[model samples]
Target: MAMQLPTCTGIRIRSMSDAHVIFHAVTLGILPIVSRRLDIEERRYIHSGCVCVWEERSAAGEGSSVTGIERWTDGRRWGPSRVRDEFLYYQEKLPEFEADEELSALIFGSRLIKQTYSVFVDTPTGRRKWHLGTSVRLRARARFYLTLICMAS
Candidate 1:
């Protein structure tokens, strides 16, 4: 399925539902940054609401289906200069920690949507990494949290 996004410059991604786990692993995998890298005195709010996903059958009689996920502007319209500034800040700070090219690209290029920072991750079998143990652990943790929420409610 196709989704129209807001008219703003920023990063957009198309990946499986488990993308957040990858982000979490990457963020916690490295040492924390003691100093803030952003120069903006005001904290820009990040709001993600518009999300769409659907399946499209391949026309080649392959019976294949593809899913798309996208997240738009972080609630604020950052101008060109601001986008560049954020990109540079991350670029400078990324080296302080250990991150692979894919992670770095996702983080640094997250603010240059104008013909840049486009990432496509394939989730099909054999195309992506599958950490079964980690996945199970995370699922158990999530279930525990959800159970707590349900009990509280």
Candidate 2:
């Protein structure tokens, strides 16, 4: 049988007191997310769109969804000139999305640093909501975080 973590529940990472194990698991998932996003940062040619894949752990939860915001061709070099133009292009469409009935957003930014300069927003309709990190990540994180909290309980 598989070894389970020792928590209140039957099987969960949180129950495991061993920091190394939990760290390994979380990192395994989060690292690729960071690396993949970093690659986009360098190219600066994001294929803007929405991904409608999210996991709902419970009945009452915000539901975390992964959405695409920006795309970069180069994997290691990008400057303000390119990123700025893209930022403006995406921000212009936010009001249009918010106006619709099937609308809500989840913002994403660089997981390495707490900067909100660029973001990836996830909408209910599976549209990629794009914006600056400080600009949108704050709002999106709140929704994702809340959903996570509810699911955990």
Best by TM-score: 1
* TM-score per candidate, chains pooled: 0.20, 0.17
lDDT of candidate 2 over 1-153, digit per residue (tens): 332211111111112233233334433453122222333233242222211111212223334433332342222222223233222212312222333333343322321111122223343544332322211233544556789999999
Off by over 4 Å in 1: 1-66, 81-120, 125-153
lDDT of 1 by residue, 9-123 (tens): 1223223334343333433533221121122331232222121121222234332433222222222333342233212111112234578999865655443222112222244
Q: Against the hidden true structure, what lDDT does model 2 obtain?
A: 0.28
Candidate 1 TM-score versus the reference: 0.20
lDDT of 1: 0.29
Q: Estimate the Cα RMSD of every predicted model relative to the unseen true structure.
A: 18.1, 18.8
**Which ten contiguous residues of candidate 1 have the minimum total lDDT?**
128-137
